[model samples]
Target: MAKTKKSARATLPPSIGKVLKRLHHPLDVILLCVRWYVAYSLSLRNLEEMMAERGLEVDHSSVHRWVIKLVPLFEKAFRKHKRPVGKSWRMDETYVKVRGQWKYLYRAVDKAGNTVDFLLRAHRDKAAARRYFEKAIDRNGEPETITVDKSGANLAALEALNADRPTPIKVRQSKYLNNVVEQDHRAIKRIIKPMMGFKDFRCARIILAGIEVMHMIRKGQMQDDGIARNPAEKFYSIII
Candidate 1:
């Protein structure tokens, strides 16, 4: 019996099987719930009803738990397969309400509208800007130039980073040139608007990262191994 159990465990997909161990629902159902929640402007109860219509009795809270648990893993997998973005970055911050308080979501996109990286911070200041820049550069490599909308904090952060580098990055303060990233924020805001607001900071951070991963997949940022996949399929492919 132990040998049989060992064989069964070995047969399961390493990441998915381990991450989903002892879960109640089938993997597909859980993944479907998470993808729909992040990819659309649907609330938790809204997802509950949708699942019910299909004869599944998943609770709204359960779906929420699944999102919190699984989105980070999906984001990790997506980053590994992410395509290379351009070096000219347009960086900005947008507001997201958490527990009735507004928080800043720092985001950036390359010259071709490809996602660079994102970070959610309590305040929009030089420290937060520097953290976001460091994270972005660490993951996607340093950009040749970064365009911002005259935000002193963002410019200051770049300056601080440049002081330590032999080749400094060019910083451009131009709202006009940043129109692409500004408009790109609408897509993320649209999906989260229906949620009204997050109840806590951690929830907001993880879910926002998931949302960004979906948005990146929609923008064709994931390398598909030479096979074409729709946005939804691409999302599942991240884990499967």
Candidate 2:
């Protein structure tokens, strides 16, 4: 069984569990499906086979259903637990395939690796960039200068924001500056593959948000526990 911490809600909205439990498969089965898929980054089919090995027969479609429905719920709960990103944000987007179609997910992370904002969209056009900016930058009060991978849409949005602002949003672009966000993404890619080819923007959003939170936890970036030890002790603890 995967380790689970009770969310603040104590229970997910009844509507979420009610619908999933209505299916013939039990909630434990569904939880097992979600945990394996999210925690281990197993694909839908892989989840099916893993469960079957333990004598629990399930189909990929059921696996997908479990994920698709629960993603938003997880997204909702995950946000409440994320640490503050504060300022100095780096942003980027990657293309992924979903059912043979392409979509974009724009994400930003602060200097300390805290995820700043994430948006899932069908396209990576100027308009999409604007939408992300209006919601992302506007809500948090402006961060100083923004760094992004070279994308004209990003430049356009930053330019527009600057022009509209009396101070002009400080804007800077550099190829190397985006390495942190890219490294963070690689950590996520190492785990999941359905995202190796995303089927839709919605799925991308759900999966990426969960990943950001997980990454922080694994790296010991959340609140510190004050456990101090020599490097050798830490190494053995991790290996064991």
lDDT of 2: 0.66
Q: Please provide, for model 2 over 1-240, each residue's C-alpha lDDT reduced to its tens digit, 9 standing for 90 to 100.
A: 222323312254675645555466655577557656765667788888988898988998888777777656655554444445666888888665666786776777778777677676788888888788777775456788689877898998788777778876666788798998887777666766654677666666676665555555565534333667443222212211
TM-score of every candidate: 0.94, 0.76
Q: Would you list the clashing residue pairs of candidate 1?
A: none
Computed on alpha carbons, the lDDT of every model, listed in order, comes to 0.91, 0.66
lDDT of 2 at 73: 66
The model with the greatest TM-score is 1
Q: Per-prediction count of colliding residue pairs?
A: 0, 5
lDDT of 2 at 52: 89
Question: Model 1, range 75-170, lDDT digits (tens) per residue?
Answer: 998989999999999999999999999999999999899999999999989999999999999999988999999999999999999999999999
Clashing pairs in 2: 97-198, 98-198, 98-199, 162-169, 193-196
Q: Residue 19 in model 1: shift from native, Å?
A: 2.6
Candidate 2 segments whose C-alpha is farther than 4 A from its true place: 1-12, 138-141, 194-196, 216-240
TM-score computed on alpha carbons, candidate 1: 0.94
Candidate 2 lDDT score at position 109: 77
